[model samples]
Target: MTEVGKTPWHLWVVGGLSLLWNAFPAVDFTLTNLQNDFWLSQYNEEQRAFFLGTAAWANACWALGGFGSFIGSLLLLLRSRHAVPAFLASAIGLAGVSYYQLVQNGETLKRLFGQAPLYTTPVIWAVLLALIFYARAMQARGVLR
Candidate 1:
């Protein structure tokens, strides 16, 4: 007997959308880490300084998180089981960076960025969690090779 519904249409839709969504962060992380002056110019003085002053480790975590999510999206598209670990890495990196931002730089970020994080962070975490669980579920269902 052959397995039915090995690949679902929603899988492709989710994977494609995930990849597209993650691309923004990935590209932003790359550009900011490289200190791309043109892009940096878009931000105000305080924002620019805050970003430039970010510690190396925090930047590393940002890179890992962004790239990990990007890779996880790709793996999902390819129907590969490796998406699990990739998502895990993304979560770890996000947690590390978020801790630094909230714990160490909260006042500074609030003074500079205002309420943006308050609105965005929760949604970001929600999507990350959903993607993680979704990927795991697909793996458990034997759709991911």
Candidate 2:
């Protein structure tokens, strides 16, 4: 058992890895929102148009999912208890975006991009949930004061 107030090595590992993992979404969100031509050139015109036409609320949720998770990872590294709520907010944001993509227009996306979304969305959720649970566990153990 870890001593109260003592930081565990795994916390650093998880925090660092999660931060790095979340960074990709952060960069994608920024570049996509900014309409970086070079960055967005990867997508076909139709796929780009479809993404660019996302609703304002969905955009907000996307921001939350990307930025909030990044913040949560940072907070975890800092050993802050606020990481829990940050991660929760990130999850909510992810749900909103996922609903918009998978339920609201799943067919459109599937038609455009095939099965990548179907495979990726669950992996994203799994990682986020694992981080959330890990943060909660750390908090309960007094490692995240």
Candidate 3:
């Protein structure tokens, strides 16, 4: 519906990348739910907790980002700025935690991702990111608050 050649850059880059993230599991699920001693009788108390905590952080980030995208994108698409961009920026900062989760190649997710692993909800992420940016743009344009 947007006029041809009128598509926004972030619309494609961020939004499209989000979709790419959703195409796969995004990050390893086991990493978040599992502890180093998940299956072992004698698990490293510190390490186990560390890994588990690490995973939790990752999920938290993803959710944070998702929430931002949800509210921001919705407002943006609606051409409003009822919510301040500062809140959205903070949310995005928290979402950065999700990026921490990921098992790369043969490396365990408990450590750090060897490389950014494929995300589980690329399409969803893309749609969400689009909303955040859209709302931000609307605010910049003086369309809303």
Candidate 4:
């Protein structure tokens, strides 16, 4: 059995991997919002246009999803119980962003970006849910305090 108040080995491994996994989205969110020309230039015109024309609310959702998850990973590493709420917030944000992409502008995006989003969005949701559950489990075990 794991000792109370002692950090488990799996926590470090999961937290580290989660941090690395989330970093890309966090960076992408930052660069896209900043409208960094060099970063924006990497995408084709349609892709750039899709990202550039995103609505303000959608951008806010994206920020919460990306940055919230990143913060959650950090909090997890710190053994904070607050990581649960952070991941929950990320889920809310991800839902909003997914709605915007898959429902509000689904046809347009599908035409512009193909079927990749449809496949990938569910995978992202699954990963986020898994993180949330893991954090909760850690908290329940008193690993996160």
Q: Best-fitting candidate, measured by lDDT?
A: 2
Worst 10 residues of 1 by lDDT: 1-10
Q: Extract clashing residue pairs from model 2.
A: none
Better of 1 and 3 by TM-score: 1
Per-residue lDDT tens digits for candidate 3, residues 27-84, read 3333335432335334456545544555455566655554444454444344446544
lDDT digits (tens) for residues 58-108 of candidate 1: 988898888999999999999999998998999988997888888889888
Candidate 4 accuracy as lDDT: 0.94
Per-model CA lDDT versus the true structure: 0.88, 0.96, 0.46, 0.94
> How much is the lDDT of residue 120 in candidate 2?
100
User: TM-score per candidate, in order?
Assistant: 0.94, 0.98, 0.39, 0.95
| Cα-based lDDT at residue 57, candidate 2 | 97
The 10 consecutive residues of candidate 4 with the worst lDDT sum are 1-10
| Cα lDDT, model 3, residue 144 | 48
**Can you write out model 2's per-residue Cα lDDT over 15-108, one digit (the tens) per residue?**
9999999998889999999999999999999999988999999999999999999999999999999999999999999999999999999999
Ranking by lDDT: 2, 4, 1, 3
Name the runs in model 1 displaced over 4 angstroms: 1-5
Candidate 2 C-alpha error for residue 23, in Å: 0.7
Q: How far off is residue 44 in model 1, in Å? A: 1.3
TM-score of 3: 0.39
Off by over 4 Å in 4: none
